[model samples]
Target: MKSTPLACAFAALFFPVIASAEAEPSGVRTNTARLMTTDAAEVIDAPVLGLQRTAIPLFAGLAVDTSLYADALLAPNLGLRWALAAGPHRVVLGARYTHFVGASTYSGIVESEAPAIQSFEPELSGPSFYGVYGLVLGPIQLQGEARYGHYTTDYLSFTGGAGFNFAGHWSVVAEAGVRVEGGSAFRAAAGIRYGGEGLGFGLGAAYVDLSDPALPGESLPVLPVLDLSWTFR
Candidate 1:
């Protein structure tokens, strides 16, 4: 199973912001930042796959984050992230591995009598390295990240948003951003979240407009997204 370009795109585009923005204020320090993000794109229309993520503080201004997820197709993915903070900015380095365990056919139809059938490849995995800069200006936050992976894939993502605190314990958050990947792949998303001091949930929607390598001259339309996460400090 060749890694879906769409999945790579989603990871490169959204994870940085999700990880950096959710860290508690106390967790931020020079050379030490704890970041955690989930790969939830597979859950949009597929079966309910579980995601497990954890962050461990190693020492002064250094931390490690890891995640594992499996989808309905039985494709398993693993990722590890190392983060270091410099003043108000965070530097992130990570790698991912994905195993495609199921068989798939290129064509939709299958006939029992057919003697020969094409089989898709059984694995797609690679390493990725990226960096993120986070700045808080008054009540708003700004973030930007750039990533490069195997197969010459490159991505740049940007996000700007703010959170509102009201009623002492309630808060509302909104964000919007654009991701440009591989020079030709483009996507955009906006989302709103509500939560308290230690927990939060969110709903997001995105539109992907990019050339499909498998289908020449074809492009995909808007896609829906949903995500939820909690923090313990």
Candidate 2:
């Protein structure tokens, strides 16, 4: 089966588990949550991962940022982003790279009297380049991203979302995106968030459709999403 670039990108962002830690924020702080859906016939179940992004001013309107993520199914991934702040918007260009650690695989079928066996295999790794733009228009926020990379195969992805702040500490967000590699998949999510002043968390649900020529037509109806982050200044 071929893996779509969107699927690989989602796996890289959300499936990893990371220890919660605090960081001192001297510059602009931004954190995001992403949903990841494992391939329908893949070995592992879908998992949610949190993303932390920090921007340190390099000059007047330019800053440099970095991101790190890890999970049991994949190796530690790191990325660097270059950001420029405009009047009421921000633009970012970044690149991410990750290596595949071996994953534990289980037999598809188990005998009634025998235990299921597990095995492992290391997969290919590669890098991706992405661009993002964010716009703030008084109580509404809009964001979009495009990415392309190679990881065992070549893939491309596009995602866009919007958020509405109804209260000082409450907001609702919705996003939809698609990815194409050897095949294509679609994903959508909606959720609510709470927090202010460099700290926030959110809970949401996502749906994924992996109905591509290279994959069995499978869909994840509802997957949970958890996001947490803190920043210091």
Candidate 3:
């Protein structure tokens, strides 16, 4: 199963100025900044930023954004976002729809087994809705989110993330989440990130909670992530 913070992302992008103009909630470069994959109640004001985001902040709690890469020629995508709260803490709701041509390559990948082809992969592509919350303190931000969709086996998911801003435009962040469908899966990641008006980036590692490697002497798998972006904020 998969989840997207389409609504929470909007609140994070457009609502930050509501609490205080000085409160740019993005301490890191991952769109909302509180988490790597999770999003906060802030906005991506610049033209382009982390992963693949091009956002246009329209007003106090409204913005327009596009997924530069994910909405590809083969995969059409669209969504809507609305921030429900205007205070220091953030609340938001949103929806997204995507049609992937060859989603099974990644979305349906399963554990390798003796039969070489254990099960047929399903094309999990459709509309998804989500809600997200953000809590911001002096220099720490926490976020929680939930999403539901029929994208894959009538899926549902919950994810949370935390970020600590230590210095100017520098912070540490971590996130963990679970997805439920025909089965349940857990994923987590932690790392440091930097968010600047003109440039931002992140360096971290991620691990998926799954079966261990089959071969002897083989350890668990850990994937490193390095995300970078530039913006004209």
Per-candidate clashes, comma-separated: 6, 3, 5
Between candidates 1 and 3, the one scoring higher on TM-score is 3
TM-score of 2: 0.62
- How do the residues 1-233 of candidate 2 rate in per-residue lDDT, one tens digit apiece? 99999999987886553321222112212233222221100001112123433334444333343333343445556555556656668676767677666343322222222333232233547787887787766667677878888876788888787777676657777878888764347767887776455565777887754343322344455678665755432
Who wins the TM-score comparison? 3
lDDT of each: 0.43, 0.54, 0.65
Ranking by lDDT: 3, 2, 1
lDDT value for model 1: 0.43
Residue 16 displacement in candidate 1 (angstroms): 36
Q: What lDDT tens digits, residue by residue, belong to model 3 across residues 1-233?
A: 54469977878877866768565544433543335555555554545544544455566556555554566535666666666445458786777787877545543454343234445454646888888888777678788889888765687888888888888788898888888763347878898887777777778887754353333343454677666777765
Output the lDDT of residue 210, model 3.
39
Candidate 1: where is the Cα deviation over 4 Å? 1-54, 61-63, 66-75, 84-87, 102-119, 151-184, 210-219
TM-score versus the correct structure, for each prediction: 0.54, 0.62, 0.68
The alpha-carbon lDDT assigned to residue 171 of candidate 2 equals: 75
Error of 2 at 230 (Å): 1.1
